[model samples]
Target chain A: MKIHEYQSKRVFAKYGVPIPNGKIAIAPKEAYDIAKDLGGKVIVKSQVLVGGRGKAGGVKLAKTPEEAEELAAKILGMKIKGLTVRKVLIDEASNIKSEIYLGITNDREKRMPVMMVSAEGGVEIEEVARVSPEKILKVHINPLLGLQGYQIRDIAASIELPRKNWKEFGVIAKGLWDAYNGSDATLAEINPLIITEEETMLAVDGKMLIDDSALFRHHDLAEMRDLDTEAESETIAREHDLAYIQLDGEIGCMVNGAGLAMTTMDIVTLFGGTAANFLDIGGGANAKKVGAAFRIILSDSNVKAVLINIFGGITRCDEVAKGILEAIEEVKPKVPMVVRLVGTNAEEGRALLADADMITAETLAEAARKVVAVAKEA
Target chain B: MSILINKDTRLLVQGITGNEGLFHSQQMAAYGTNIVAGVTPGKGGEWVMDGKVPVFDSVKIAAEATGANTSVIFVPARFAADAIFEAADAGIELIVCITEGVPVKDMMRVRAYIDQLDTRLLGPNCPGILTPGVAKVGIIPGDIAIPGNVGAVSRSGTLTYEVLYALKQKGMGASTCVGIGGDPVNGTNFIDVLAMFEDDPATDKIVMLGEIGGTDEEKAAEFIATKMTKPVAAFIAGQTAPPGKRMGHAGAIIQSGSGKASDKIKALEKAGVRVAKHPEELPDLFG
Candidate 1:
């Protein structure tokens, strides 16, 4: 999960990383007041869950309070990468003597949480890693023996940092490690760890990505889940223990496994139909969950037809058939539905659904084609 | 001969008192895998069946008592890594993990710790292996597999079943099928299983299934191109998947401008492997 810049900075502060003082404001006037209180030039950054905000003109610097208000007004309702800016963070501007980069993330090759440091900063780190790959230094920290002294010294010398700044850099590195480890963050990054003219270090910008699988252990961080960024069907699907992703199309798809769900959607597209959403009822499905899944699919405004595909392995097709019948009783959907049941007890399940108003197909490809044709006619 | 498990395979079921453990243990035993013992921590000196499958408190005692060679885990994700550590410490040769949602960090540490040992771990969130008509380990349906010569490896569970069903419909059967789980980091990779399949003389053809995440497929493609002479056909799912969205599997996302279906397909085709456009199209290309 992606957190707002302000929230990430708050988490960073707890680890003794120096971040600029900032206040979140929902209105232009509030932004101006916060900037005025800071008593110097402040930066107003739009708070959204997407990247490339600066390129989208969601970031602005103001010399005076009135200018701050003007910039905030322009940014408040502005859309960056399809997300509306709900709030603006007004932070005290720091004087930058130089810029550097630091972050920790999992390296698939090493299967360890690797820390990366680079002297070139304030740009897309990916771009830097692509162009001048030699400038970046990476250290893979063993989770057993985390953030070792040798790793810190190795990275500092590799990046050619001045001897005086080595101590401060080490502190920031340790702080970032603690925040990342303590918060269950998949990614903890500071693109521009700036050294100011006052000879002090500050984390100029911050980004953190939390691990969803580890959310149950971090109760407080899970509370920070942003509902506005998610579709209603997605939120409801999670509540019902289903995996749902909204897509553009008329045929609504509900399938059993994650891989089969994607293949179902792909085949639908191959047959020239678009899926309204991708919903996987998951492994062990009962009548209640299946009924809930049907309701969620029907809730989509674009859906003209629904396709239910189940290749039951451990899951009995007859049990899924009961769920479909229960869903038909509850939703009574006006949209056309094409049901395909295969695998364990699939014969009994297909027999059970035979009396329903929905259409049935034996093969997955044939079922996908049937749904597209029904949707096109509708 | 099968690549992973066969008729002589002695099996130990971890977390055997749980629902999944009990159901799959019976299934494996019924499918002809030698069910030796079970481990449930506190259920030592107990029995799962009418003493057909004995229960031990730890894997060490179970290994010593039953002389079990391989173990399958069905524990919850919170304690899965510890279960792996326990089974490894007991010197289980091969470990198959069926639990999903294990934290990547925990697996990272687990992978590192297991590196120094002699154990090969399969899935933290995977369906176990099936040496068809001989031994069935985890959740893959044993009925669909008829025990022929084709070898299979995949990243998804039910989809693996779907592909096997498709092959079975065409009167083709598999020597062995392995589900390596769909996480970013795993213990055994495509290369590990592919090399085994290549060396097995019973296997005449190979079916490799991949999704749109990670460079595992690309690496496998390279291996297939330069190393193997066996007839290989491949299928990659998630062709219509949008960028930066994970399609249910934790490792199924297309992140950082990599792991696209088109790129993987292109690499495989260039490697001279017959790539199936759809799952149903795989049977025609298998020959």
Candidate 2:
């Protein structure tokens, strides 16, 4: 789950990371008060979950409280990256001397948590990786031993930090790692960890992405989830305990397992078909789950056909067939459907489904072909 | 002849007292898995599932009493990392986490810890691994799997089943099929599984199921291009997925041109992996 920059900064500040004083505002008046409290010069930033807000005119500098209010007003109702700015963060402006970047994330290849630091900050790290790959420094932490003083020093030196600031940098790096580990964050990044004219380091921008699976242990962090920004279907699916993802194609896919769902779509496309959505009813393809899946698919107007593929193991094919029949009755599926039932009691499932208008295939390949044909006919 | 597991592998269930944990644990046991013990915090000394397997409070105790080397986790996402670490610390050789919604950061830390140890971690958000006609260590339906020569790997669970069903239609079955989970930073990648399948004598052909998101597919394609010797048939879902929208899989999002179905298909095709344009074409490619 991604938190807004302001929220991330709040968490960072709690960890003793220095950040410019900031207050979140939901209205222009609130922005004005925050700006006035910050002594007039402040940065107004839109509170969106995505990046490139600056390029999208979501971030603006204000010299006066009135300008801050004006900027806030302009941003409050504006849409950046499909999310309207409902709130703005007003932070005290600081004199910048130099900018640096620091972040912690899992390095898949190394199969370890890696801390990344660069002397150059205030820009996207991907650009840094592509343009000047040498500028970035990476340090992998030993999970058993945790981050040590030497590891931090090595990263600090690799980033070419001055000897005078090495100790402070080390301290900040260790703190960041601690926060990352403590919070169960997948990524904790401070883009543009600026050195102020006063020679003090401050995290000017903060971004954090927490792992959703870990939310069970961290109720405090889980409460920070912004449901409003998430997709309506995804939120509802979670409530139903169904694995659903809305896609853009015209064919709705309902399958029993993950790998099979991908292959079903792959076959659909191979047969000149476009899948509208990816729905996995999991191993529990009961009448209710199948009914819910049907409703979710019908919700998408783009859907022209529905593909139901089941490879029953613990999930009996006959039970899945009952679910499909019950769902068709409940949803009155307007679109065409291609059904494939394999494994346990498949023949019984096929016999039960045989009476319906739905097309049936013995194999997933045939099912995909049938669905593609149905979609083309539609 | 399977990649990671067979009928002889003894299984331990972590968080066995929970609804999903107990439900899938029973199903796995019924399917002939040697479920040695179950672990639930403070729920020790009670047998979950008709007193068949002893339930303990810790992985160490469960391992010591049962001599189980592999663990299947049904713990909630929050405690999943701790469960994985516990299993790893207990010297379990393979850990398959069936928990979903674990924060990517936690998995990274857990994965980092697992890397330091000799244990191989499957997922914090994945379905777990299934060796056909042998041991099923995840939440996937056991009936769909049949012991054969085709090796399947996928990021989506339901989708993985579709591929297996398609393969079964062509008189082919999986030696071992693994669902690596659909997360941005998963413990095992397609390349990792592909390498395993390549080395396994039982696996003849490999079917790779990928989705849009991240550069994992591109990396896998690069590896397949250079290292793989077996015939590989690949399929990428979410081709019709709207840009910027995340599919059912959280990691199945198309972002900034890096992880798109088209990009993945191109990369895989360039790597000499047989690309299936539609699910129906999969069987033809194998033939």
Colliding pairs, model 1: none
Identify the leading candidate in terms of TM-score: 1
Q: TM-scores for chain A, candidates in order? A: 0.94, 0.96
Instruction: Give lDDT tens digits, candidate 2, residues B234-259.
Output: 87887755666556566777665667
lDDT of 2 by residue, A1-378 (tens): 788898888888787788899999999999999999999999999999888999999999999999999999999989988888888999999999999999997664455678888888999998898889888888888655678998887777777777777776766787788878888786899999988888888899999988666677778888888876767887787778777777678889887765466556666776788887677777656767777777888888899988888877556788888877887887787889888887768899899988999888866667788898888888
lDDT of 1 by residue, B87-176 (tens): 999999999999988988889889989999999999978998988888888989899878888899999988888889999999999999
Stretches of model 2 off by over 4 angstroms after superposition = A158-168, A314-333, A344-357, A376-378, B1-3, B6-8, B11-69, B89-91, B114-160, B173-287
Per-candidate TM-scores read 0.96, 0.85
For candidate 1, write residues A1-378 as lDDT tens digits: 888888888898899898998899899999889999998589999999888889999988899888999999999999988888999999998889989899999888778899999888788999888889888888899987789877888888988878888898888899999999888788999978998898788998899999888888888888878777888888999889888999989999989888888888989999999988878888878878888888899989899999998998877889889988887887788988999888889999988988998899978899999999999999
Sorted into a CAPRI-style docking class, model 1 comes out as medium
- Angstrom error at residue A201, model 1: 0.9
